[model samples]
Target: MSENRRAEVDAALADVDFEKFNYQVVFETTKGTIKMDLYPDVAPGHCKNIIGLTKIGFYDGIIFHRVIPDFVVQVGCPQGSGTGGPGYTIDAEFNNLPHETGILSMARTNDPNSAGSQFFICLGRVPHLDNQYTVFGKTSDAESEAVVLSIGDVETNHSDRPLEDVKITGSEVIVTEK
Candidate 1:
């Protein structure tokens, strides 16, 4: 991401009133649209990072680089591989959120604070991730949840890359009165 774009994202995030407004990110993917509700109260920084990135068109055309059956469907890697990010990182905000199906969490390296733009939506209960990853959001409705689960069921090679490309065609941030 460009420095100017990052600055614009920061400026926009600063104006948000989390207490009075609800934030959502609607992702248009090759499979279907998945709308996720952000939990700013539990993981404010993670929520802001995703919302900011979306507003800057950072997720457009990104592919779901990693998918594991009964696990997670990961995306937001600009390189269309699991090794890329938004050129910067955010500190972790681990909370008590359970890593159940439809839950959204940040993907990071061993360092908890290394999360950047990569994230995953759970396809089943992942108890090992509870309070380990930064859980910031979840599928907002049943339809969205179904889409995420379906994405997770896609066939992958040895590296977990989808046999067929599953790209995020576009993304949008939705803010509504709380």
Candidate 2:
């Protein structure tokens, strides 16, 4: 998509009701396309940011900043995994959204409102992360198994982890009427 077209979409979304921002992500990657339902009801702004970045191709070629085997697979940093975004930041928003199976959350530093363009998908149900990370969406168990299994390497620490076989081809938002 062109930058102008993406900007138009972003502007259009700014007027959309928070609840109406709900949609699903069809992530077409090297493994496959995984469709995940977004919970704007939980974190509208975070989900909106995700949709906006995706529309602008901000996540293309961006590595999965952090991928913990049998835990979670995170991506969405134009800076390359832990270092990418739209050159801006958003104040972190918290809600009742819990970190459960397929839950989506935003990545932020110790400083709140520091979220740029990094997000993460819960590979499994994580109860400890409840009320911490900014969840935006969750992956459907049956949407696309290839996505969750596309891990190409294993890292020992949070220091510059990468998924050699995965790349975000693109994402689409299917907003629903409030």
Candidate 3:
């Protein structure tokens, strides 16, 4: 199943001209809309994986499963828990990108190469995560950054799960000529 899904993703992205175009993922959530620009130059695999997932509606209706104040708001789990993925994992593409406010990075197990569909948006500067996680994108504007921080401020249980569901109602991958 994992391989099949991976093949599908690859086929979907086979015609993309990453160098001549820009890719962004716009997420419509219960809180508000947030747009993120992918850093394909730094993490092409992670960028492609996310774009592929979004294009296929993999993130629609997915809830933010984890939220940490002044840290990050996480989502993209199919089960609305921190344990599910899109059936496969991608290798880490750690780069020099700092994990500062509005930065988007992948969520994975202790294994460095275990990231799949799950990702998080930093609400504040998180230097410790720099070069540790794959930083593939970031909130495209101030409004988008504000929405992510607002989600981070939501009430949560001891486990960091949001008390009220913060869901991605829809998602779209926008490709524009550069």
TM-score of each: 0.95, 0.78, 0.96
Q: Which candidate leads in lDDT?
A: 3
What tens-digit string does per-residue lDDT give for candidate 3 at 1-178? 3323676777778767798999999999999999999999999999999998888888999999999999999998888888888888999999999999999999999999999999999999999999899999999999999899899989999999999999999999999999
Alpha-carbon shift of residue 92 in model 2 (angstroms)? 1.7
Higher-scoring candidate on TM-score, 1 or 2: 1
Error of 3 at 104 (Å): 0.6
TM-score of 3: 0.96
Off by over 4 Å in 2: 1-9, 12-22, 149-160, 176-178
Best by TM-score: 3
Q: What's the TM for model 2?
A: 0.78
lDDT score, candidate 1: 0.91
Give all candidate RMSDs, comma-separated.
Answer: 1.6, 4.1, 1.5
Candidates' lDDT values, in order? Answer: 0.91, 0.66, 0.92
